[model samples]
Target: MPPTSPALRIEVRGVDATEPAVAPALRFLLRLEADAPIRALTLTTQIRIDATGRGYDEQARERLAELFGPPAAWGRNLSSLLWTQTVTHVPAFTGATTAPVTVPCTYDFDVAAAKYLHGLPDGEVPLRFLFTGTLFYAEEGRLQAAHLPWDTESAFRMPVEVWKELMDRHFPRTAWIRLERDTFDRLYAHRVRHTLLGWDDAVRSLLETSGG
Candidate 1:
């Protein structure tokens, strides 16, 4: 519950003027270490700055606080979350400040993600939000680890970009849906004609493998 070490700013080096809005996310992607821990200097999700930190959006802090709990609050930051999850971090200062510990972070995508997706709101979300990475997961309302990483493709066999965009445009509110016969048939036909991979065969294999 140690407030992400009082959310502070540090003069980071090697960060380009144009970096991904999510630095940690970029770090994970660029490195992609099997279980390597990562550290980066970026705007704190907990600290609210009047000035936008370079490429970071001004509202990122507020938005994150609203979606997740207050990460800056004494007991609600990532440090506390990681502690609860038993992910170890090295206590080292960086860029004139001590940030989240640098350690090899592990992401067990398959297990943790299956849990998160089962409960997320089924709604029209921007397709841009979709990406392949380990998302933070705290279960039983308890933070589980540094994160539960997932290759969005391997984790979910669905063509998420296409599906999400379609749903966002077409099905804004409905959930638990089964595509109509005509629609499914059309999609299946399109898959057969365009993509060499047989949708039915691949899907059937996945279903059988998962025991679904």
Candidate 2:
């Protein structure tokens, strides 16, 4: 008879931002434990921001108004935000092992997760890491494969400062926004006509002109 697969457990140790590079990213440290030796592990993780798990101050609530509406209506409006989904390969190990799951990040505020993250002024961000994948092990002399249980998951409360630090490392004290080509053309023309020193000057001019 074939042997039954051993149970596995997953835990999130911590999270941090990657060093300055062409693209920004966050690395989540994961610890995997098993009753038996694992030949290899193909891990897939879906990370989510539990927006409703943490309390928000008045300032944060106002900042997040666009996403969750006003604080008065938050009970019905707030929901989890999907941060990212990524896959990683875990090397062979016995008992327990640690691995990093790197998730690429973006400064684009158009993304809901980014918008939600940027809205927070302080405190931790409640995160849920849902794990699913295949595990390979040895039985007798032959190798065996099995699917990780559906219930495999971990919870983490990552400090908002971690994300803010990463962004500050890459962007300094600046923010990014996207504009349509036509809109950009108009803004560029205005900049050139008005001899604006920089993009910020051009945008500030338009905002003042429109009384925004």
Candidate 3:
């Protein structure tokens, strides 16, 4: 009879935002265990935001209209949103092991994931991680390879504060906006014509004119 493959399990132990030493990133601690020795692991993780996992206050719902349409249509619109895909290697281990998943985040409002995360007022962000990859192991003194089970997954409720802290460290009391080349040229021209001391003043002036 052929050697049976070992069943693998994964769990999200904890999360933390990197500081100046490791700026602009969030790291997740994953604990993995298996019945047999794992020679090597190449893990592909798909991170998703479960919009329906948490309740949103009235104010938060209003702020999230752009992403989910309106509160009334939430039942249909509030599905999981793919945040990012990351691949990390796990070193050889026996029985159990812990690994770190470093996810680089962006504060650009143009991105849907960024917008959704920024719109949240408070509370934990529900995250679902789907994993897939190849697993290497040794059976009866012979090396072997097997496909990771399709149902391998993990759920984590990451605190919003972690993300907020990361952004604050990278951009204190500021935000990022990406503009088209033409739009930027027009804004620059207006600033020069108005003798605006800085980009902030030029933007404030435009906002005032538009009653924003």
Instruction: Report lDDT (CA) for all predictions.
Output: 0.29, 0.92, 0.92
TM-score of each: 0.18, 0.96, 0.95
lDDT of 3 by residue, 25-134 (tens): 89999999999999999999999999899999999999899999988999889888989999999999999999999898998888889999999988999999999998
What value of lDDT does candidate 3 attain over all alpha carbons?
A: 0.92
Measured by TM-score, how close is model 2 to the native structure? 0.96
Once fitted onto the true fold, the runs of candidate 2 whose alpha carbons sit more than 4 angstroms away are none
Write one digit per residue (lDDT tens) for candidate 2, span 72-164: 899999999999999999999999999999988888999999998899999999999999999999998779999999989999999999988
- Ranking of all candidate structures by their TM-score, best first: 2, 3, 1
**Number of the candidate with higher lDDT, 1 or 3:** 3
Off by over 4 Å in 1: 1-86, 92-96, 101-113, 122-196, 199-212
Q: Identify the superior model by TM-score, candidate 1 or candidate 2.
A: 2
Alpha-carbon shift of residue 44 in model 1 (angstroms): 20
lDDT of 1 by residue, 85-171 (tens): 112222323334332312121122233222222223332111111122122322344433332222221111222233333333433
Which one wins by TM-score: 1 or 3?
3
Candidate 3 Cα errors over 4 Å, as ranges: 19-23
Ranking by lDDT: 2, 3, 1
